[model samples]
Target: MASEAAATGSTNTGILGWIERSGNKLPDPVFLFFWLIGILIVISVIASLAGWAVQHPTELTEAGEPVVIAATSLLAAENIQRLWVDMPTTFTHFHPLGYVLVVMLGAGVAERAGLFGTAMRAGVRNAPTALLTPIVVLVGMLGNLAADAAYVVLIPLAGIIFHAAGRHPIAGIAASFAGVSGGFSANLLPGQLDALLFGITEASVETVFGDWTANIAGNWYFIAAMTFVFLPVIWFVTDRMIEPRLGKWNAEAAGNAMAEEQGDRPLTDGERMGLRWAGLAVLFVIGLWLLFTFGPGTPLIDEEATPEARLTPFYRSLVAGFFLLFLLAGWAYGKAAGVINDHRDLVKMMAGAMEDLAYYLVLAFAAAHFVAMFAWSNLGLVLAVNGADFLSSSGLPAWALLAAIILVSGLLNLFVGSASAKWALLAPVLVPMLMLLGISPEMATAAYRVGDSATNIITPLMVYFPLILIFCQRWQKDFGLGSLAATMLPYSIGLMLVGLALTIGWVALDLPLGPGASVFQEIPGTVNPVAPAAAQ
Candidate 1:
């Protein structure tokens, strides 16, 4: 293993091994949030005593001077009272909670109905040997729409497909894993993650710009572009760096990777019919949305609003749109596939989806309190002000500041695995601070996605890392955790660099992040603070 890792110019015995060890020592993410809240209370009390404050950017006095904003003690009578009284509201009103649950209600149906699985099989079923790597990577990226389907279905199947094609099974597994986990955030269309992250972004935005509501698809265009940027990187790493180092697979030596009956079968006639039905369902949903947008009422299109504001309604509707799209398509597919018999069965699938979110609900409870308390203490705003001031004074170019955010998110991803949990902790500080420094919430969220996705493959702490390792060991009994990490390291490093460059270039070009979403947000009270690229 050491020789193989050395040959590939990767390492798992030193800093990376230490990272894996230390990361495991951390508490459960749920308990970690609770601990953070306890720590936040202490910080709030001290900051209040020290008179930590900043001038409110929007709030002003009768004379038109900026109001001096100060930190409030979480232990104060009013704050403690609100905490106890508002506990229910705090948990219930956590924005990401509803967004995630609703999306999953529909998605779970799709995954169970076999739509996601069959779609993946169809995509890579007949790929030519020459284009197999890119095809696998692309399918892996698209398979992210199903969340678990990519990891559980497509990745292992890639190994079989490779073996049958007379290629190294591990290389196929590596490429698929890279595309699925390493390119976690890159997708052609906004899905559950978009709803979850942007919901949190909206919540974070309220602390700084109270009137600014985030569109669920706020980072749509940017993430779509990431799909292209990452596809090639995963392809390059898998073919050039990873495959060259992995010796040929020995079919005789490798144990059966899966049960004899478990190898991917050609889609059944019923499944193919289900797929056709699902396709029709998707088209119907898209057409319905188009009609709603362009028809006489133009409910989704605001005629009275500014050009940039016109599509806000359409963007917001995407949450519901995704729900209906997945629900109807899954139901259609299930009906044809004989997986669902009646409306009662449909209801069961939705319930099953909610059942899957049980852990997320617990995590959201801890995160909600942390976010709410951070806002109530006034520290969220104060930190943003102070951080923005320091960042501004540092004279780091705006593009560089955005790049720094990507690096911070990527580094933190090594220890914290849940995307929402990390973003919940980060968005409060990173989003508001960057917004105060004249970066858009869209841009900040986009940068976080890039960084968060790139490092997922190398980290052992990622929830799926062990599962992936198990998959690899099925083919090669000697495959260990370090071997898996070493296999993915090149993909991690390559994606990070490409994603960083993409982010920097996006900011430098001042491109729109999504519908009406720009790289810079103009604060009402001040000139745009983003420093020019050449000025750096």
Candidate 2:
């Protein structure tokens, strides 16, 4: 044991080793927020004492000039009092908190009822062996809708599937990991992440463009495009590059222990019935949404409003619509599968889901305070204005500017792993700064996501990185952090390049990102806003 431990320690000594060491030394994400809050307080005090201030770019005073914003010390008497008195409200009102909890409340039921697992099994089990790579990769990409469930269920199961098919198990693990982590941003439909990140974007936009609203589907078409673009990349890389390198499946040499441990079990009758019901339930919900959207009364569309204004109701209802879709489908599946016996069983499933989120609740509390404090200090605005000025003076093309944002965001992902946390920090500066540069808030958000997701597979800081390494180790006992990072490096580099190219092309084409979302935000009275294509 000691010799094995020593060898493992030796492997973590170079660049990957340094990253692992440094990342491990840092505090957990929850405590990292507290540390940031503390640092921000001290900085606020210093900046306030130094009389640091800035001229607001857009907001004007009664005198019809740019408004001056001054730093406010977080430790000031009134500010300190507000923090203690409003702690609960601040945490609860955090934008992403409610959005995540509500969606999970329903998704949790689906997962606990075994709907996700059985569904994934059915999909992968039926794939022709010749197309297993793309099937696994595509499922992994769509699995983001299940959030963490994809990592826990699909990835390990993939290894077993590959082994059963007489293919390399590590290659299966690699393909699944590439889809789950590397393709984190690629999905056919939006889910909790869309709500979470856009909620933050809304808050940041309100800081500068007060009337601007966040559309959850702002990056819809781009991300949907990503799902298709990344599929072939994963297929090619796994089949031609990764699998070829892994050689062949040697059940005897690999001990075949893991294969036995995780038998390839086909779906039972009850599971099939449950899946049928779940499918019908999904279609039923879709029918209802469409009926309301286009039917005579048209509750989801405002008849008296402009075409753009008509989408507001539809966009706002998606959160609730998703909730009902998952809830009804899970309930239907659970009933048929015998996983849920009664209403109490359904309640129990939802409660169990919230239990898993206990850590997130704590993290959200800390993060909320940090974000609110940053806003109160005016530090975010000052930095955004200054940053915007610097970028504008550089005379870089808009596409190049967005590409730089994606690159910087990708680099930052290696250090900070939480998408919401990182976006909360960057949005205040990046969103507003980009808006000042003629880029819409949605466009800035789309850029951030491309960069944020491209490097997840390569970063040890990502929460699931260790978990993915453990999954790989099940196939090759010697697989360490460095080994996993090296395996995923190609996907990371390739995906980042693809993401950058997509962003550049999307901007150059002047396409609408989603319903009522444009590539540029027109300054009122200064220029006419570009009309977006009507939402379908």
Candidate 3:
């Protein structure tokens, strides 16, 4: 039945059709952002009636005022009046947005300077066929720390490198996609994401207990463990499952060849020389950072403080500072190499950068509205507290709770694709509830991260779902959303299992997530017996 449908092709009609047809057509992020907002508004209307009507039974009847006007006015009112008036105050309360933008500014320069593209090409350019699979996957996974840049650079590059090595390009795309989007949370080096999550966690925890802190490494150990676990699974799945099905490409495939001629011409002689200088510049910056982080009387690190202080605001700033450092190095390199002839060219690079982010912008806008609406309704908080109560009452083992959370997270991901948005909604309730159950905020956050990251590649709501469709179209000219989904289902299942296993193991081990972060024992007498609870 499936093959018959594939042969005639009615597969691209619904969600799958949306995925297949939209491949690289619209900017993804923008589209997702808007869609999420629209959905949130719909949900908000429903929630407002459900919540408000439940609270004020008499308001269900119309007074002298028109019913619609009265309901609309009432719904328009704010839950927290202070927060409603002080947009900047509430906005700043969600500090992750700033950190993300700050880092992107510097990253934007590195990419504009051709540093990232050059490095990727240099890394994968003449690699052996046997090692190509793992190398591509590893590179893709590591690329997550740099934000969404990997999708534009690595995915297509994998096809080129694989084709050059006399292998199927689809195999390359599959392998790289697995690493970048699939293994997004599995970075060995903690990046801006860690800091962002920690900030949210810290804030959420504080709402429950008077004083609480979440560490930068809140999800580190779990992510690191997944790094090793993902490598072999990606390799085997790409080689055995995806590649064999793809066979070889035809003349149509030649059109999508990954060539540097269109972007910036292969690094010029001057650029190579500039790279040497840039390399030295990077070293200098690293030396300075080390001195500040460890040297006596250095402001970057507070010498009198404990390990957590050494990492908190200091490391957070350091992560943002990386973007600036990269930008500086790239600008110097571009100037030295003569690639950046003038300010106009530099602006063009950044402009071109914006073109790629069109989709992301769309997704963000919708996602922002969706998240805002979701928060406005207060359903997430209510549901989380209720769920936590049930879980806590069940007397289930921690491992079982962790597994259940992972499963629910993966399932929820199918509907809501934005990681930060989902977590923001989840954290305020789950974190604190779990904390009361002897699960640290760090552990709960870690479990949530694993579940969230594991299923991203399979979920059509993922902004880049369309991008993966484009990748599939190269080999299977008939490839659409269903094709992409079918191809990725195995990897999703594999990663889900691996992610859950690692999470369970971590809970069992009771390891520290990062400095001063732990898996067990929330502060005693933390929960308010009257109120359900806030998240960790």
TM-score for candidate 1:
0.94
Please name the candidate that would achieve the greatest lDDT relative to the true structure. Answer: 1
Among all windows of ten consecutive residues in candidate 3, which has the lowest summed lDDT? 65-74
lDDT of 1 by residue, 1-536 (tens): 33333333234568777887789789999999999999999999988887777777777799987777778999999999989999999999889988888889889999888889988998987899999999999999989999988898899899888877878888999999998988888889889889999888988988766866768787888888998999998888888888889977677755454534346678889989999999999999999999999988999998899987899899878888999999999999999999999999989888988988899999999999999999988888888877887888899988898788889999999999989989999999988888877888999899999889989998888888877777777788677778888899989999999999999999889988888889997864542232212333
Over 4 Å off, model 3: 1-80, 210-214, 248-278, 305-313, 341-389, 524-528, 531-536
Which candidate's TM-score is highest? 1
TM-score of each: 0.94, 0.93, 0.76
When summed lDDT is taken over every stretch of 10 residues in candidate 1, the lowest stretch is 527-536
Please count the clashing residue pairs in each candidate, in the order shown: 0, 0, 21
lDDT (10s digit) by residue, model 3, range 1-536: 23333343344577655543453243344455456556655655665554431112011245533121111111455634633575444444454555555555666766777666666655566567889999888888877765666887878778777776778777788788889988988888677677667666765665434366455655666678789998899889998888888776554555433444223235567767777767877787778777776788777766677864665655555655576577667777778877678877766765665566555444444444434444555544444444555776788999888788888988777767778767765776677667667788888888888888778887666877766666556456676667677778788888888888877877788777765567887444422222322211
lDDT of prediction 2? 0.83
lDDT order of candidates, top first: 1, 2, 3
Q: Please, what is the whole-model Cα lDDT of each candidate in the order they appear? A: 0.86, 0.83, 0.66
Order of the predicted models by TM-score, top scorer first: 1, 2, 3
* Residue-by-residue lDDT tens digits, candidate 2, 1-536: 32343355455767777776676677878888899899999998887877777677666779886667777899899889889999999888877787778888989999899888888778787789999999999999988988888888889889888887888888998999999888898998888789889888887876655666667888888889888888888898899888888787777655556756764677889999999999999999999999999987999998898976987888888878888888989999999999999999999999999999898888888888888888888877666666677777799988999999899999878888889878887887788778777898889988998999889998777877777777777777877777778888888888999899888999999998887888987632221111111211
The per-residue C-alpha lDDT of model 1 at residue 29 equals 97
